[model samples]
Target: MPKSYLITGGAGFIGLTFTKMMLKETDAQITVLDNLTYASRPLEIEALKKNGRFRFIKGDIYEKEDIEKVFYQK
Candidate 1:
């Protein structure tokens, strides 16, 4: 089975770098949760939208409902 990843802060530099590394090295399904905070650059992540294994959510980790929505997503 393919691995599934929930990456917080994924629109930030290091996070985006690690996400790219994962994509290059493994067949993993990735979900990114970011609020487009000051440190985040949505444009960088936007390029990843073309990958079927990747998904992005515009949400804050501090929000309970947002976290629950990602967790329960089918």
Candidate 2:
């Protein structure tokens, strides 16, 4: 089974690179949990978005509801 990755700061340089590397390796699902803060650029994540395995969520870590929405209740 493919693994799920929750990558914080995923829109930044290192994070974005890691996201791309993961996608290139296989069809693993990745959730980019970035606030899109001053340092982060939405455009940086655009290419990853083109991959079906990549998902971007515009949210802050402090927000509980946003975090909850991403996970399925099992």
Candidate 3:
């Protein structure tokens, strides 16, 4: 079975780097949760969207509903 990943801050530099590395090295599904804050890179995240295994959610970590939705995602 393929693994699944929930990556917070996944649009930031280090997070994006790790995400790309994982995408290249593994077959895991990646769900990226990011608020698109000043430091977040939208273009990079958009680029990742080209892959079928990657998903992105625009949300803040402080939001209970957002976190809950991700945790409860299928």
Which residue pairs collide, candidate 1? Answer: none
lDDT of candidate 1 at residue 7, scale 0 to 100: 96
When 1 and 2 are scored with lDDT, the better candidate is 1
lDDT of 2 by residue, 1-74 (tens): 98888888889888888888988886789998888878887886886678788788877778997787568422
Q: How does model 1 score by TM-score?
A: 0.92
By TM-score rank, best first, the candidates go 1, 3, 2
Q: What is the C-alpha lDDT of each candidate?
A: 0.90, 0.81, 0.92
Q: List the residue pairs that clash in candidate 2.
A: none
- Model 3 score (lDDT): 0.92
Error of 1 at 40 (Å): 1.1
Winner by TM-score between candidate 3 and candidate 2: 3
lDDT of 3 at 8: 95
True-structure RMSD, every candidate: 1.0, 2.4, 1.3
Superposed model 1: Cα runs more than 4 Å off: none
Order by lDDT, highest first: 3, 1, 2
Error in Å for residue 61 of model 1: 1.2
lDDT of 3 by residue, 1-74 (tens): 99999899999999999999999999999999999999999999999999999999989889999998787865
> Which 10-residue window in model 1 sums to the lowest lDDT?
65-74
Model 2 C-alpha RMSD vs. true structure (Å) is 2.4
